[model samples]
Target chain A: MTTGAYPSQSTARLTRERFRAGECRPTAGIAPGMTQTNLIALPRDWAWDFLLYAQRNPQACPVLEVTDPGDWHTGLAEGADLRTDLPRYRVWRDGVLAEEINDASACWEVHPDLVTFLIGCSFTFENALLEAGIEVRHITDNTNVPMYRTHLPCHPAGRLQGEVVVSMRPLPAAHIARASTITARYPGVHGAPIHVGDPKALGIVDLDRPDFGDPVRIEPGEIPVFWACGVTPQVAVMASNVPFALTHAPGHMFITDVPDSRYHV
Target chain B: MTTGAYPSQSTARLTRERFRAGECRPTAGIAPGMTQTNLIALPRDWAWDFLLYAQRNPQACPVLEVTDPGDWHTGLAEGADLRTDLPRYRVWRDGVLAEEINDASACWEVHPDLVTFLIGCSFTFENALLEAGIEVRHITDNTNVPMYRTHLPCHPAGRLQGEVVVSMRPLPAAHIARASTITARYPGVHGAPIHVGDPKALGIVDLDRPDFGDPVRIEPGEIPVFWACGVTPQVAVMASNVPFALTHAPGHMFITDVPDSRYHV
Candidate 1:
């Protein structure tokens, strides 16, 4: 199920209930003031390694909440069921994409000891940048933010190892400092731009050709600023060939009841 | 072995080597410019719960580094051995204090899969406070900072649950805001004071008698300011009756090669 637009007035709980009822859509605009989280679930054995990986690479994988083994409930959202709450779920088997479905309840039967991780999403800070009168090109163009895999390797933890993946947003050179100051307040999300000007510095060859998401236009005086992407954890899962895993489909995030302000320092 | 005073000109490596060679003394004044960490080690099975506990109660237990299971190495201090690079350690069995030792190497044989966590200490921020021209009473008096076991229960994570423990410093009312703003910059360490005045609000009965450490004088116009303390995780271990655990003895912290400025925002 897909909706052209979700009601902006809807609360996070109501929005999650809609997703649970199979209303599949990206959660960016829904529950505007609430926090949206990226979800990943791994079996108990691999959970420790993944958690350590997140700890080591916090810029790319700022953790919001981690649920207990076999538990689907998260403290971030009251009365929400992780098994069927999100708009869509990706099921991975031995590191390869096995299936993309609207409901993940059946997948839990195969691996009952799955531990869920809710990670901070950049959408929270994008709101702050917009409030500070900084233009977010991807939001203006109504396209997914361009993300690329970089040569910069993430700190290895336990059995997990992967290179960094970053999301790019073109901003006017004048607004770069203001954008950095605003986003730095939200470290729970990917905080501040890692690289402000050159794409080659991060080993990216072209801004037009992104490994993930849609590319947006770069204005005459604008520079491409890159922030560590949440997808870096997904890359680690794939590169490490995790035996079994589940994650929210790209853009189809889990809207938590917690407000965006809670993450603001 | 005990020394009257460690030379202030020494580097963290030299200080750690001295501690490793059995120099029994408090670490606060030993490593003048480097970071000193509170250490805790737990068996593999209990590590997850304790990590979750710290995540849930970050104010009281800000985590600096977590070592891999059965790994004695920490990224915070290169070439520092977790088993012997501390002035002292406390070995606990079934939640009871079993032995206090200068070396933890012998105890590791029993729980070989132990995971070590290096936690942020108040001493890091206390230095900042002093630099900001705020008086640190305990340091001036040459006494341990007064700590109280509060009725404020930490948000429970997994099987680990405990009350919040706070370190009190009597400061002039005017310095409270500046102190908060200063410490808030160092989120890696315990960021800001949780309570500024009225000990009774935290269920703390008396200002003169603290549960741990020595009492300090509260001047006429000065008020008691309580910040979350590093002793919290140890309190959790005691409250949860953890089967096997090892922690640095109070004040006998593990000096790390990392500079305290690295913890400053």
Candidate 2:
């Protein structure tokens, strides 16, 4: 449900309650002003490599918080249990999708060496962009943000190595500078746009057919702006072929207690 | 040797040459415009906890780069061997000071699981402050910057936990604003001052005495400015009492290839 229908704090509580009860749905447009996070849980043996990967490629994987081995609670939210806080989760085994589940507690219990990482999501900055009078077309159209795989190679860390993945938002040519300036303040999120124009330069042959998410129309005089997507790490993790890994489904995020403004410089 | 005697680039190379040749000395003012880093090497088993500790307490441990397991080469400095590039090293065993040596290669070789971490140093921001017309009393007086053990406890991660340590710089009341603004741009370093005017606010009793480093004179009109020190991670790592750890001796840092200006927003 959209945050407009409920009070901000109660909306977040309601979202968590729904998720805990196995109500599987996307988390977009929920808990306005509250930060949402991309979740990744890996075995303790593989966590250090992923942490190092995030450190090396911060633009793509801006970590908000990380839990100790086998811990599910994060300081980012009060009484938020990571095992059941997200609306949906993607379980991977040997770099392949094993199953989609609403509750990951069973999987987590089996692998007691799991460590959770709360990574900053672009949705936090989208809220700021909306407040600044910049239109986030996906939110306006009530659809998933368009994302594409780029040729830009991320710096390799241990066994985690892959090309960067980015989300696209088409904006008017005039709003490009203001949008970048506004988002640059929130480096805790994905930060500013990585590319302003020419998807071809990023090795994306077709803007209308995205590798992930629904493609949005680019009207006359509007340019597609690309920001590093949280998917980059997920893709890298999958490519690394770890024995088992879990991540929040696309558009299905873990809502955090941290305000969006906290990330603003 | 001070950087005033050679060109900036040559000075960095010269400093590294001397360090590699076993010229044991403090690195302050040796490469004026270049960035210097605090080094910490820990076994792979403990590296995850240390990485988590650094992530939780980024202000105190702004990690510049973390090497893979048993790796010592860092991209921060080209051909700068982490094993011998630093003028001095402190070997810790069971959290106690084991020995001070000019080289840590032998120690690292013995513990093949060692992973090196290069953390940002305040010397980079100090250079920025000096360029902005702020006086760094320690550099002017040719003494080590004053550091103190504050009552501010760091957010614990895994087995690592300790009080936050701060390096004090006395700035004129009028320059505090500018110094903070300038340093805030460089979050790679300690970012802005954590505390501004009063020493007692941070549980620091006397300005003339410090827990580490030589105390500097706090002038009559100067306000004591405190920035989170890199020594904090070392303190926490020591307190964790890991089997073996290695860190750079105070003021004897690893000279990085990155320029100070790169960190500026």
Candidate 3:
């Protein structure tokens, strides 16, 4: 829908309308200052475990809000219906990819015990990094931020457990400290960089080939920095082998009324 | 057994020793610089709702760590037993004050399904405030910090729901901004003053008579500042009328290996 091209207060509403009308697309750079979230829906029985998992590993899965069982609305975005507001959704059956859908309302109706979780996305903090005059390679290159699976294991909660996943950004060595300081303020998002320098430290052999998303160019003086990715929970949830689950497609986030400034210290 | 008189690295260990020996006393000023926590033990069944409630209200109930069902040890403090480390514990029966004891191990043994929650206490931030050269009135008076029930209702989760409870500190008008900034750095420990002036704004009437803790003197030109108190969860748990629950007694806290600086931004 290219809602980012028309940045305004109405961007969130317009983007949501397009998603409601079956237009599936990435949500990056849309609605400028507004916060966007990663969505995960699970049965009420597994919701507690997932909630605890988020609490135990907040940096990878910073939960903005969790809806009550069978509820689809979030207070972060007034009047926004979670069931069909996001551009696209991925449904999983027994930890395997089952279907890709424009809206999750049908799946949710079948799983009446569903609980929706709104998790903070790195896009919010990336906006802050841009405002701080730090260049974000992906946005400049018009591609999704490169992400990789890390050797770091997340603290397990109930049946949910998996390796941590991180998103990468490359910036000049001189700007690393400032970039960290700027992003650290938005803990609601992914917060500070988890690793800087050697990608091998996190077990990533090649920066050009990412586990998820697209790789961006690393200039001569630039160093790759990594932040915990919201995808960590999706991987963990899939590994748990739950009977069914619903999640926002990679880069297709649910826009909220909350502003990026709301997360700043 | 008054460990407050012995402020040293060994204070936490010595305090735990005293607690093990059945010396029940308040924990205020016992282990300076060491992070202290509020304890809440609930049945595994009710633990999910309480954990969700804490997640929904991080300022009031900043969860440092939550134990797996029937486990008493926490990573926050090595070798520290949640059942017996705190100098005193309060047992609630059907939402009413049942008994105050030296240790909760007995009640825990009887319940078999208890899940312990270690929640961050304001004492960590209070230590930062003192280091910032701000005077904490109750500490100066060698009394418990004055806490009051407020009109602000916490976001309810399942059976847990109640008004927010705040701890009051009267600081000079000029220091309010500095105090807010200092405390804001410690989001793990309540973080910043929720109310700066006008106690009546939070439905706090009669500053001299707080609903919890002792009243502290407020000199002229000083304004009453309020921070979300750990007591908020205790109040909510009580109102929910859980059959049995255990909490650290007012002013008695669980000493952890974590330092106040760990929470700093």
Candidate 4:
């Protein structure tokens, strides 16, 4: 999912251009310096609920940009068409996955009043973690990060309500603090780890079995750290049985022109 | 508007209790350690525009908490009724001031689907400034902080559109940086000064005659520092000619049970 090339701004544009030209791939490493976001497009009627939900649970759903209803442009990415710029998209009908596609133009035609939200993805902080000398287990293994559903309830907003879903990365006990301090600088991304050292604490029984993405190797001296994942809004959409929705496929995020440093506090 | 005597958590609760019983006074000094907020309630249909407007112009309209439609309870204050707890309220009808009153319960009866938004106020950070030994001019003068509607345009969201509004404070040139650094820690509370030194830069011709609140003396060797003010949203509501709205009367803000330190980043 990561190229580790650390593309420049122009390169970031080129990556999105390629995606617009029908190339599909995970966006983590392609634009390391630029920001990558989790995409969620909800109907105009459901927009308020999702926006309020994100506002309430900022740690899990830090909104980078929310497009006006029926608008596909975001200020974060210049000259980028959100409908076509993402490498892959998932269209949902009545809370269930309808189909996975490379372009969402057809979905917009069916639901023109969709309001798109570009939420901060934790992948934005992975470069900082790696630079701080901490191993992001999923990136190190060249695989999608492990994620789990938890019992933690997010503050309900209007029609949207669901439990928090968290992504896991096993860090050596010594590097845990450094990893936290590094990621905490970017609250626009998922800030620091929510819990560390116990899977039971988050109500997970097995380390190897993840609800989404592939499981990674957890070394003996490593502690499992959990972060509020961007997938939370999708979980909420599903739980609420939203009539129609669209989201970026897991690990295949929307790469923006905004530099990761812009979100740094 | 400031009391200088920083109160504890219990005093904060007592203060709200008094307001709930119809005590009408500015909330500054009554709960110095607790958070203060700017209240704006709009009909459910207009809620999306205002929420998106706040999200886009965070510096001027930092949202603390937003209530569900027709709901008056805020999680920021436990058991505090939004309709009755505040000292005063301004009822707006078709973008004009319809009336000013001590309680908004009657107004809610007419507009049952109003969604209330609690916004961050600069008063929440004034205590921190004073504790750091920086003299806050408005607090020193016992006046409402002077606010101005700037020529700077806010990023429009849906139907809401207006310019940035700023609160000004004159500080000794040496203390300007310290004041900025101090307030920058509380992003939820308007964060830092948007401008310094020149009032002309913000299109203000006179310092003595402020558009809102009272003017403070700018001493020799002192420079005027400007911060994004909570009034920006009211300005937007007026500019957009919103059919109906409710806001706390200027200087008479809603005091929350949450500590001022809780907003510190």
Candidate closest to the true structure, highest TM-score: 3
Which sections of candidate 1 miss by over 4 Å? A1-10, B1-10, B29-33
What digit string (tens of lDDT, one per residue) describes model 4 on residues B1-265? 1224345666776877888788987666566778999999999989999999999988889898998899999888777899988888888888888898888898789999999999999999989988989998877777777888899999999888999989898999899889999898787899889999899999998989888878888888988899998888888878989999999987788888788977776
Question: What is the C-alpha local distance difference test score of candidate 4?
Answer: 0.86
Question: Which of the predicted structures, 3 or 4, would earn the higher lDDT when compared with the native?
Answer: 4
Question: How much is A168 displaced in model 3, in angstroms?
Answer: 0.6
Rank list by DockQ: 3, 2, 4, 1
For A113-230, candidate 3 gives per-residue lDDT tens digits of 8998889899887777778788888888888878898989999998999888998999999999999898887788888899999899998999999987787898898999999988
Cα lDDT tens digits for candidate 2, A85-173:
89999898998889989999997778998988899889888877888788888888878878898999988888889888999999999
Off by over 4 Å in 2: A1-7, A22-25, B1-7
lDDT tens digits by residue: candidate 1, A1-265: 1222334325777888888898987665556657788899999998888877887787888888888889999887778999999999988887788899999998779889989999888877777787788888877877777889999999898888998988888989899999998887777887778888989989999899998778779999999999888878778878888888899877678887777777776
lDDT of each: 0.83, 0.85, 0.85, 0.86
Chain B TM-score for the candidates in order = 0.91, 0.94, 0.94, 0.94
Q: Grade the docking of candidate 1.
A: acceptable
| DockQ of the candidate models in sequence | 0.45, 0.57, 0.60, 0.50
The TM-score of candidate 2's chain A against the true chain A comes to 0.94
The lowest-lDDT stretch of 10 consecutive residues in candidate 1 chain B is B1-10
Q: What CAPRI-style quality would you assign to candidate 2? A: medium
What is the TM-score of each predicted model, taking all chains together?
0.92, 0.93, 0.95, 0.94
In terms of DockQ, which candidate is strongest? 3
What TM value does model 1 have? 0.92
Model 3 regions more than 4 Å off: A1-8, B1-9
Specify the poorest-scoring 10-residue window by lDDT in model 4 chain A.
A1-10
